[model samples]
Target chain A: MSLASLAPLVDAAAVGDPQEGVPLALYLAVSGGLFLLGLLGVLTRRNPLLLFLAVELLLNSANLALVGFSRYWNVTDGHVFALVVMVVAAAEVVIGLGLVVAVFRQRLALDVDQMSSMKG
Target chain B: MGERIVFTIAAASALSFGTLVVTLKEPFRATVALIGTLLSVAVLFLLLAAPFVAAIQVIVYAGAIVVLFLFVIAYLGERPIVEIGDRLGRYQAFAWLAVIGLAIQGFVVLATTQLPGVRDDPKQVGDIGSPEAIGRSFIDDYIVAFEATSLALLVAAVGAVMLAKRAVKSEGGR
Candidate 1:
């Protein structure tokens, strides 16, 4: 779903009574904010390693939102998706870090701006 | 009362640490904040009654993933800190403005909307998040996706090893 549709759902979730349980809106807000922060980091940062961390944050933010929705709907689907995403993220990191290591070893340039060989 | 209090604390800490992970100058410090952010999210998962997910969040994310990052940080020793001057271009200004606008919009939506019973009944969701239930669904409903994930992971492991070895050989040859 588009982020616009999610806005009211988040607001609606947040406005509910809290004594019964944690509100879905609060979870959504936190996850959304975290996701945005990670995006900003990815756009602004130069360090490849830091970029990796930012990407992790982005994935985790998505996972959090998924679990929240799963709980809201009372389904197991979100949990499974989160689990699979976790595996995918782990694999991505392994390969990405390996590439980073290899490149650093070759020329010791850690900044993204410096690695322009692929820019065509 | 306790749930609200815990949720407030966890949410606040998680957001702050998440921001730190993004804005910190030193990569190592950012890594630490990232750990804190993950741990706080784990607490939120626990509060949400998904104990299994919370445990995995700790073991895989806080433990394995962050440690892997630390290993990379150690390998790339003494990298220059991100310079703050002479780099903020026009796009950077627009990006910051966009972030602020989004935050304001989120605040407005959160403050204005009201939906009762948005979450499921506590009784209904109780078993759904448990490890046994999740595992059952994994085997029964998501078997194909699960199998694909395993295959992908194996390939990634092999690829990572090969890539690193090739890089080492090339460097040596040079």
Candidate 2:
């Protein structure tokens, strides 16, 4: 009934023999490193388009971690979640770029800091 | 042997190009670096035995998304807004230090945690990430969520079109 009770069944499919597949820590390191790069980019970059790219990097890093854990646990959930995230990303980009195009059509300032027109 | 080598190359390339994507000032070059990062990550997916995800990653991410970025960049023709000589500020230094600290904490966690089966059974995860399994999940337990995603996508499509469209009538008919 509960998730803890399902541990045995879940572990049956998990990365049974760790000697064969890649090390889990290595994957985690790479994913975390990429995520940091993305965070740094988002923090430091001013260009909105560059910011979008950094966001993509962040999403990809999350995906990598999901897949790694999926393989480690031998489950389908992570794959499905990552796939759904990918689709969400596609939809996000469409709207984001559309908004950018519409706004830039009026006044083409590409800086993220310059878009704060909703002042109180 | 082969597996470790491939993983190293893939990880190295993924990080390298990812760094380039964040750091590069040129829009065109940054986009290309992002493509490289996507491709490398896809390869890593393949190595992780998610062949279906790897293929989709290539097809959807590298093939479609990056190309869409390229098209938008080309059409906009607006130069990257990052200026020379004054790019890095105190804010950037603070960000760098904060991220490095976060990275160190994360690395510590990764080093200490124990996996369920480490060097024990030595069995491979077979076909879990295959299309069949994923499709079953989409239709079975995740059916509602999957259908909701489709509806959201439809709305997003229409919304994107509406947002990008100019009001010619309001502007006295262009």
Candidate 3:
């Protein structure tokens, strides 16, 4: 490709602001990083409470992307969806912590790997 | 230039605190890190001009959900954690690979030219997050989904009570 043809691509990158708002990629990159951190936590952490927290991180990252796209499109739809996700996340945490508390009371253990008796 | 500075600061704080939330040894300490992450994200929302979502994020996630998590932790009390073999060490390579892969994907998607630019002057876009706008959209287009969320919350409350009450009842009987 000619250097002249690539000039526009570089210029697009150089454009600090678009009329639409902030660049979509910036938000997506943060969201992806947050999601991966949460993934690592869920994979490596044994604590159920931390696991719930990691899941919360994942949900928050998704919310960030939603709001970003809402701004990108200049619409209210993404905002509403993000709101719904928040509600669902709240509910999920309540049930999750409740289960953890119940299980802890029963066995005084929160080691999820040890909860394998359901295989019976 | 100002926007660039704000974005940089917010993104840095959000990512660092998010990492801390995952990697911190103490769950309570991790929860504090989570608050930092949420607050930074709220700032990003403000930058995006969605003040309403920003406020909701602060009030709901930072204010309510996090407090709920702390209450549970306090009630449960801290216990000595068993050393699960060094899973992080074993998975460290894979984690790095996955993160790099996600970054590349995001870059390619973002680089695509298919995005439609803002429909109107970005600054001229008025109160998309205002209650009037949100309520109008919520009722006109998303009424069913909105109602579903309320129902889900109701179910969650009852289910939580049921689970906790059952545990208490069993203990009392014993």
Candidate 4:
């Protein structure tokens, strides 16, 4: 389906009255799909950059689920936790990128498969 | 309303760009996609009623972190050389399936279980959105964590400088 249609459905699930709108089941399904896509990227991709992107996707999926639950319950803690997760994600990207640069300088390649050769 | 529309757009952008970050063969394209994803995620944060976080997401993530990624991508050269296979091995596939299954199960449980409902008290609403309120709360409730985050940033700066200096030395020697 088109993403435009999916938006209303997701919004309805997130903010609609408990009885109507998109069902929680559907929201969870979408989250599951995203998580699976990320997992496939991580498992199949050999590039460290792509692997990190997959990791970010994994985190974003979790954030989506968190926001969905928060909206359903009408609380702010999930939102706060999502904020914390974002901060941690930013920090992770910095450190991960640094490591990537260092590794690339040493090995002149960005492949995760080649990183296995750690004979210094 | 506008909020919902903005949230939808942001979420879609984040997802599509995130996918591109992984699927693009060129590391430069991946870095660009990553930056787009981060910007969209910051917008998502704004939709969630956390403006402070949204600002931080833009400033720290899109601004600083992504620049770091781009620098690395540039330094490593922008050659599109990485080859990707279509499918993972059996064990990896199984592991991915298991993770997805577990996440779905957890979501189902949370959706079905009768946990304490979300508290929408006026008091809770009053303290969450404003920058001043967030700052006050951080200082009051999470002082140590906040301080630690600052320390971490300091360390990162130092480490980055060290690495740059080493690179300069090695290049000069060559």
Candidate 5:
């Protein structure tokens, strides 16, 4: 495409204002990057606590995307769903930490691969 | 332009603090970083025009959840961590490669889209994400799901108690 046709796309990236709100794709980029970083942590970090923290990151990324879409569409549905996600995340952390405590007590080891009683 | 600057700062902090959450080895340090990321995301929510959600994000996610993490960290205390071989296991190269690929793809999509043009005029659209709107939805459109979340939280609390207690009881039996 000619630069004449692509000017709008370039403008869209820079048209940041409170009244206009942020572009949806920029939020998506942030969310995607956050998700990737969390994925890296989950894959690489064997510590269950750290793994849970990474999972939190992953969930937060999802929330950010949901809110962005909600704003883009000018609706509250995305906000509601984001709240649901927050609740689920809290529950997940609670249960996860409980399991971590239980498992860590059984053995002082921290690496999750070693806790493969059910098999890794 | 003021909003844009704040959004830029919030987004940057969210990403950087998120990186710290993953990279920090100590649980407490990672959790502190996680709070920074969460608050930044909360500011992002405000910029998105969801003030109610932004408040809840801070009160519930940052305040409640991070406190839970802190309590767990305190209860568990610190322990020496042994190095696991290969770090990220056998797929280290593949994982980093995936990260790079996704980054490039996301950047391309973001660069090409005329997304800002699609955004509605906030003044004409009215308050779509106000507390009243969201509260109405929770009761009218999503009552069942909202109730289900409460049930799920209750179940999770009971299950955690049972699971954590079972471990100690089994240890006593031994």
Candidate 6:
């Protein structure tokens, strides 16, 4: 098959409803996948910094879905919600990084497994 | 067609960078990858007709928060210890499965709830992209939230300085 012939198939796989000029399903799927990846990272990674990044990814994935849905519904509420989410996310990152700094200073490490003193 | 192409590129780049953010072993590389993800997300925001929010995403998240993350990673230096063990157990597997199932069920419920005659409308792309519009709306409609956010930022700044100071003082004492 010619490369040009295969192009449509590839595009179709990545996006649905070309006539609509938007790929709602693809956006939703990718956002959900990103969220799952972040969730797995949080569950599996030992590094606190990586965990923090993963948490941010999870938040961003939700934000993407919110914006996508808002566009699909033709409403401004989704955009407003996304803005609020970003504000909350910023606050979260500040506090989270601060905590990481405090923990590292005390123990000289970022390993989540080693910080088990508070597990009791 | 141009819009579709832009959406495809933005979505692909965002997903790829997001994956790299988690998979990269070096904290610094992962932080850089996260910045890429944020930039891609900002592009997505613009494509969605939210130029104002997209600008804020770039300025606040990509510009400030990510720089802070990089600084933290750099300041910590290289600790010999790295990987932590898996925190999840078998119960977590079931928990995740249940959550996914519930999410799918909820989506089905919502999809079914749409009115029979409802039709998708073309987005009314507003003049909301202008700084004037955003400023006016923010001041008039969201003034309380905006002021609260400023206060929160103030508290965060003070708290961050205090946290860093304590660390410095303790190190000096030792």
Worst ten in a row by lDDT for model 2 chain B? B79-88
Q: Show model 5 residue runs off by greater than 4 Å.
A: A1-20, B79-88, B113-124
| Local accuracy of candidate 1 as per-residue lDDT tens digits, B1-174 | 567668778888998998999889888899999999999999988877678999999999899988998988887877544444334355677777777887788766655555555432343466778999999999999999999999999999999989987987887763
lDDT of all predictions: 0.82, 0.79, 0.81, 0.63, 0.83, 0.73
Misplaced by over 4 Å in model 4 are A1-37, A60-87, A117-120, B1-4, B78-92, B116-124, B165-174
**What's the DockQ for every one of the candidates?**
0.41, 0.32, 0.45, 0.23, 0.54, 0.29
Please give the C-alpha DockQ score of model 4.
0.23
Give one digit per residue, the lDDT tens place, for model 4 in B1-174.
455456557657777887787678776778688778768766755555567766876786678766766776677775544554423344666766776787667555534544343212111233355667666666777777677766776776677767666766666643
Per-residue lDDT for A32-77 in model 5, tens only? 9899899888877888899999999999999999988887777889
For candidate 5, what is the TM-score?
Answer: 0.88
lDDT per residue (tens digit) for residues B80-168 in model 2: 44343433465678998989899878856654455655323325776788899999988988998898889889999999877755633
Q: Rank candidates by DockQ, best first.
A: 5, 3, 1, 2, 6, 4
Model 4 whole-model lDDT (C-alpha atoms): 0.63
CA lDDT, candidate 6, residue B142? 80
Model 2 fnat value: 0.52
Query: By TM-score, how accurate is candidate 4?
Result: 0.71
Task: Give me the displacement of residue B64 in model 6, in angstroms.
Answer: 1.3
True C-alpha contacts between chains kept, each model in order: 0.51, 0.52, 0.51, 0.16, 0.64, 0.36
Q: Residue A25 lDDT in model 1?
A: 76
Q: TM-scores of the models, in the given order? A: 0.86, 0.86, 0.85, 0.71, 0.88, 0.79
Poorest stretch of ten by lDDT in candidate 3 chain B: B115-124
Among these predictions, the greatest DockQ belongs to 5
- Model 6 alpha-carbon miss at residue B166, Å: 1.6
lDDT of 6 at A19: 51
Model 3: docking quality category: acceptable
Q: Give one digit per residue, the lDDT tens place, for model 6 in A1-120.
A: 232432443456554545545545556665776787677667666678899899888888888888777667665556666777788788878878887888876765677777778887
